[model samples]
Target: MERSQPNYRLIYHDIISIKCPGKKEECSPILNKKEISILDVIKLNMIIFGINDKETQIFNQKHRSYDESTILEILDYQAKNNLNNTQLANHFKLSRNTVAKWKKHFKNKHLHPVKAN
Candidate 1:
Protein backbone atom coordinates (compact mmCIF):
# COMPACT_ATOMS: atom_id res chain seq x y z
CA MET A 1 0.00 0.00 0.00
CA GLU A 2 2.80 2.39 0.84
CA ARG A 3 4.52 1.70 -2.46
CA SER A 4 1.30 2.44 -4.29
CA GLN A 5 1.45 6.11 -3.29
CA PRO A 6 3.71 8.56 -5.07
CA ASN A 7 6.77 9.84 -3.23
CA TYR A 8 6.92 13.51 -4.07
CA ARG A 9 9.67 14.31 -1.60
CA LEU A 10 13.09 14.92 -3.08
CA ILE A 11 14.53 11.68 -1.84
CA TYR A 12 18.16 10.94 -2.64
CA HIS A 13 19.15 7.62 -4.08
CA ASP A 14 22.48 6.05 -4.97
CA ILE A 15 21.72 4.45 -8.28
CA ILE A 16 24.43 2.53 -10.07
CA SER A 17 24.30 2.68 -13.84
CA ILE A 18 26.47 0.52 -16.03
CA LYS A 19 27.00 0.22 -19.77
CA CYS A 20 28.05 -3.31 -20.42
CA PRO A 21 30.80 -3.84 -22.97
CA GLY A 22 29.31 -4.67 -26.37
CA LYS A 23 25.88 -4.90 -24.77
CA LYS A 24 24.21 -1.55 -25.26
CA GLU A 25 24.99 2.11 -25.75
CA GLU A 26 22.78 3.38 -22.95
CA CYS A 27 23.65 2.94 -19.32
CA SER A 28 21.06 1.07 -17.22
CA PRO A 29 20.25 1.14 -13.56
CA ILE A 30 21.91 -1.88 -11.96
CA LEU A 31 20.84 -1.85 -8.31
CA ASN A 32 17.85 0.43 -7.77
CA LYS A 33 15.38 -0.88 -5.21
CA LYS A 34 11.88 0.36 -4.45
CA GLU A 35 12.03 -0.05 -0.69
CA ILE A 36 13.80 2.53 1.42
CA SER A 37 14.17 2.94 5.17
CA ILE A 38 13.24 5.88 7.39
CA LEU A 39 16.91 6.43 8.16
CA ASP A 40 17.57 6.59 4.46
CA VAL A 41 14.81 9.15 4.05
CA ILE A 42 16.23 11.47 6.71
CA LYS A 43 19.90 10.95 5.89
CA LEU A 44 19.43 11.37 2.16
CA ASN A 45 17.54 14.64 2.52
CA MET A 46 20.73 16.64 2.30
CA ILE A 47 21.07 20.06 3.90
CA ILE A 48 22.51 22.47 1.40
CA PHE A 49 25.38 24.75 2.34
CA GLY A 50 25.23 28.59 2.42
CA ILE A 51 21.96 28.59 4.28
CA ASN A 52 21.33 31.30 6.88
CA ASP A 53 22.85 30.75 10.31
CA LYS A 54 19.43 30.36 11.96
CA GLU A 55 18.32 27.73 9.42
CA THR A 56 21.63 25.91 9.75
CA GLN A 57 21.29 25.80 13.51
CA ILE A 58 17.71 24.53 13.25
CA PHE A 59 18.70 21.82 10.76
CA ASN A 60 21.59 20.73 12.96
CA GLN A 61 19.20 20.17 15.84
CA LYS A 62 17.24 17.51 13.97
CA HIS A 63 17.73 13.91 15.08
CA ARG A 64 19.47 11.52 12.72
CA SER A 65 19.81 7.77 12.64
CA TYR A 66 22.04 5.52 10.55
CA ASP A 67 21.74 1.88 9.63
CA GLU A 68 24.49 -0.65 10.07
CA SER A 69 25.72 -0.33 6.50
CA THR A 70 25.81 3.44 6.75
CA ILE A 71 27.72 3.22 10.02
CA LEU A 72 30.21 0.89 8.37
CA GLU A 73 30.55 3.27 5.45
CA ILE A 74 31.28 6.18 7.78
CA LEU A 75 33.86 4.07 9.59
CA ASP A 76 35.40 3.14 6.27
CA TYR A 77 35.66 6.79 5.30
CA GLN A 78 37.35 7.55 8.61
CA ALA A 79 39.81 4.68 8.17
CA LYS A 80 40.60 5.55 4.57
CA ASN A 81 41.20 9.18 5.45
CA ASN A 82 43.19 8.26 8.58
CA LEU A 83 40.98 10.55 10.64
CA ASN A 84 40.42 10.31 14.36
CA ASN A 85 36.96 10.21 15.92
CA THR A 86 36.77 13.94 16.49
CA GLN A 87 37.92 14.74 12.97
CA LEU A 88 35.56 12.21 11.46
CA ALA A 89 32.69 13.56 13.55
CA ASN A 90 33.45 17.10 12.47
CA HIS A 91 33.57 16.04 8.84
CA PHE A 92 30.21 14.27 9.03
CA LYS A 93 28.51 16.69 11.47
CA LEU A 94 28.23 13.92 14.00
CA SER A 95 29.05 13.86 17.69
CA ARG A 96 32.50 12.54 18.48
CA ASN A 97 30.93 10.29 21.12
CA THR A 98 28.66 8.73 18.51
CA VAL A 99 31.62 8.07 16.22
CA ALA A 100 33.56 6.56 19.10
CA LYS A 101 30.60 4.38 20.01
CA TRP A 102 30.23 3.18 16.43
CA LYS A 103 33.92 2.39 16.26
CA LYS A 104 33.66 0.26 19.37
CA HIS A 105 30.47 -1.46 18.26
CA PHE A 106 31.52 -2.31 14.72
CA LYS A 107 35.23 -2.75 15.24
CA ASN A 108 35.16 -6.36 14.01
CA LYS A 109 32.67 -5.85 11.21
CA HIS A 110 33.64 -6.11 7.55
CA LEU A 111 33.97 -3.01 5.42
CA HIS A 112 31.26 -2.29 2.82
CA PRO A 113 31.66 1.29 1.68
CA VAL A 114 28.54 2.99 0.37
CA LYS A 115 29.55 6.33 -1.08
CA ALA A 116 27.18 9.23 -0.40
CA ASN A 117 27.85 12.39 -2.32
Candidate 2:
Protein backbone atom coordinates (compact mmCIF):
# COMPACT_ATOMS: atom_id res chain seq x y z
CA MET A 1 0.00 0.00 0.00
CA GLU A 2 1.25 3.48 -0.79
CA ARG A 3 1.62 5.68 2.29
CA SER A 4 0.85 9.35 2.60
CA GLN A 5 3.94 9.59 4.79
CA PRO A 6 6.72 7.29 3.71
CA ASN A 7 8.56 7.81 7.00
CA TYR A 8 5.73 6.10 8.86
CA ARG A 9 6.03 2.91 6.84
CA LEU A 10 9.04 0.68 6.82
CA ILE A 11 8.28 -0.77 3.39
CA TYR A 12 11.56 -2.65 3.14
CA HIS A 13 11.07 -4.23 6.54
CA ASP A 14 7.31 -4.61 6.11
CA ILE A 15 6.76 -3.39 9.67
CA ILE A 16 6.15 -0.04 11.24
CA SER A 17 8.10 1.33 14.19
CA ILE A 18 6.49 2.55 17.33
CA LYS A 19 8.09 5.15 19.58
CA CYS A 20 10.91 4.02 21.80
CA PRO A 21 9.95 4.42 25.44
CA GLY A 22 10.74 7.94 26.67
CA LYS A 23 12.46 8.66 23.35
CA LYS A 24 10.04 10.86 21.54
CA GLU A 25 12.38 11.70 18.71
CA GLU A 26 13.37 8.18 17.84
CA CYS A 27 11.12 5.40 16.60
CA SER A 28 11.36 1.92 18.14
CA PRO A 29 13.08 -0.96 16.46
CA ILE A 30 11.27 -3.32 14.10
CA LEU A 31 9.70 -6.44 15.64
CA ASN A 32 8.04 -8.41 12.88
CA LYS A 33 10.32 -11.38 13.59
CA LYS A 34 12.63 -12.65 16.29
CA GLU A 35 15.98 -11.31 15.23
CA ILE A 36 18.77 -12.91 17.24
CA SER A 37 21.16 -10.48 15.60
CA ILE A 38 21.39 -7.76 12.97
CA LEU A 39 22.66 -10.26 10.43
CA ASP A 40 19.64 -12.44 10.99
CA VAL A 41 17.33 -9.50 10.39
CA ILE A 42 19.01 -8.77 7.06
CA LYS A 43 18.62 -12.41 6.05
CA LEU A 44 14.92 -12.25 6.82
CA ASN A 45 14.42 -9.22 4.58
CA MET A 46 16.35 -10.88 1.76
CA ILE A 47 13.98 -13.84 1.79
CA ILE A 48 10.87 -11.71 2.20
CA PHE A 49 11.68 -9.21 -0.57
CA GLY A 50 12.95 -11.74 -3.13
CA ILE A 51 15.85 -9.41 -3.92
CA ASN A 52 19.53 -10.06 -4.18
CA ASP A 53 21.04 -10.82 -0.76
CA LYS A 54 23.55 -8.03 -1.32
CA GLU A 55 20.73 -5.51 -1.72
CA THR A 56 19.13 -6.66 1.51
CA GLN A 57 22.45 -6.24 3.30
CA ILE A 58 22.95 -2.74 1.95
CA PHE A 59 19.42 -1.44 1.59
CA ASN A 60 19.83 0.76 4.62
CA GLN A 61 23.58 0.54 4.80
CA LYS A 62 25.41 3.70 3.82
CA HIS A 63 28.70 5.58 3.92
CA ARG A 64 31.14 3.10 2.44
CA SER A 65 33.18 3.08 -0.71
CA TYR A 66 31.03 1.95 -3.62
CA ASP A 67 32.80 -0.44 -5.93
CA GLU A 68 32.46 -0.41 -9.70
CA SER A 69 30.17 -3.42 -9.69
CA THR A 70 27.85 -1.81 -7.19
CA ILE A 71 27.82 1.40 -9.22
CA LEU A 72 26.97 -0.54 -12.35
CA GLU A 73 24.27 -2.37 -10.48
CA ILE A 74 22.60 0.89 -9.52
CA LEU A 75 22.97 2.22 -13.04
CA ASP A 76 21.37 -0.86 -14.51
CA TYR A 77 18.52 -0.80 -12.03
CA GLN A 78 17.86 2.87 -12.71
CA ALA A 79 17.75 2.32 -16.46
CA LYS A 80 15.61 -0.79 -16.19
CA ASN A 81 13.18 0.94 -13.87
CA ASN A 82 13.26 4.21 -15.80
CA LEU A 83 13.88 6.10 -12.59
CA ASN A 84 15.13 9.69 -12.52
CA ASN A 85 17.71 10.92 -10.00
CA THR A 86 15.12 12.06 -7.47
CA GLN A 87 13.14 8.85 -7.80
CA LEU A 88 16.22 6.66 -7.54
CA ALA A 89 17.50 8.57 -4.52
CA ASN A 90 14.20 8.31 -2.69
CA HIS A 91 13.77 4.65 -3.57
CA PHE A 92 17.28 3.77 -2.47
CA LYS A 93 17.40 6.10 0.55
CA LEU A 94 20.43 7.87 -0.85
CA SER A 95 21.28 11.50 -1.29
CA ARG A 96 20.16 13.27 -4.48
CA ASN A 97 23.77 14.23 -5.10
CA THR A 98 24.81 10.61 -4.94
CA VAL A 99 22.17 9.62 -7.43
CA ALA A 100 23.13 12.47 -9.74
CA LYS A 101 26.77 11.44 -9.59
CA TRP A 102 25.94 7.85 -10.45
CA LYS A 103 23.60 8.82 -13.24
CA LYS A 104 26.28 10.98 -14.79
CA HIS A 105 28.80 8.17 -14.47
CA PHE A 106 26.43 5.80 -16.21
CA LYS A 107 25.78 8.17 -19.11
CA ASN A 108 29.49 8.66 -19.69
CA LYS A 109 30.65 5.07 -20.02
CA HIS A 110 29.91 1.44 -20.64
CA LEU A 111 29.64 -0.92 -17.68
CA HIS A 112 32.19 -3.69 -18.11
CA PRO A 113 33.14 -6.39 -15.68
CA VAL A 114 36.64 -5.87 -14.39
CA LYS A 115 38.96 -8.38 -12.71
CA ALA A 116 40.01 -7.32 -9.25
CA ASN A 117 43.56 -7.84 -8.18
State the C-alpha lDDT per candidate.
0.54, 0.50
Across 1-117, the per-residue lDDT of candidate 2 in tens digits comes to 853323322443334223222332222244344332333344444444446566654755664445555567666667777777677667766777986676666665645422211
Global Cα lDDT for candidate 2: 0.50
lDDT of 1 by residue, 31-88 (tens): 1335454433433333212245867756764655577777887788887777878788
Error of 1 at 112 (Å): 8.9
Steric clashes per prediction: 0, 0
How many pairs in model 1 have backbone atoms within 3 A of each other, for residues 3 or more apart or on separate chains, i.e. clashes? 0
What candidate 1 gets wrong by more than 4 Å, as runs, is: 1-61, 112-117
TM-score of 2: 0.41
Which residue pairs collide in model 1, if any? Answer: none
RMSD in angstroms, candidate 2?
A: 14.8
Q: What pairs collide in candidate 2?
A: none
Deviation (Å) of 97 in candidate 2: 0.8
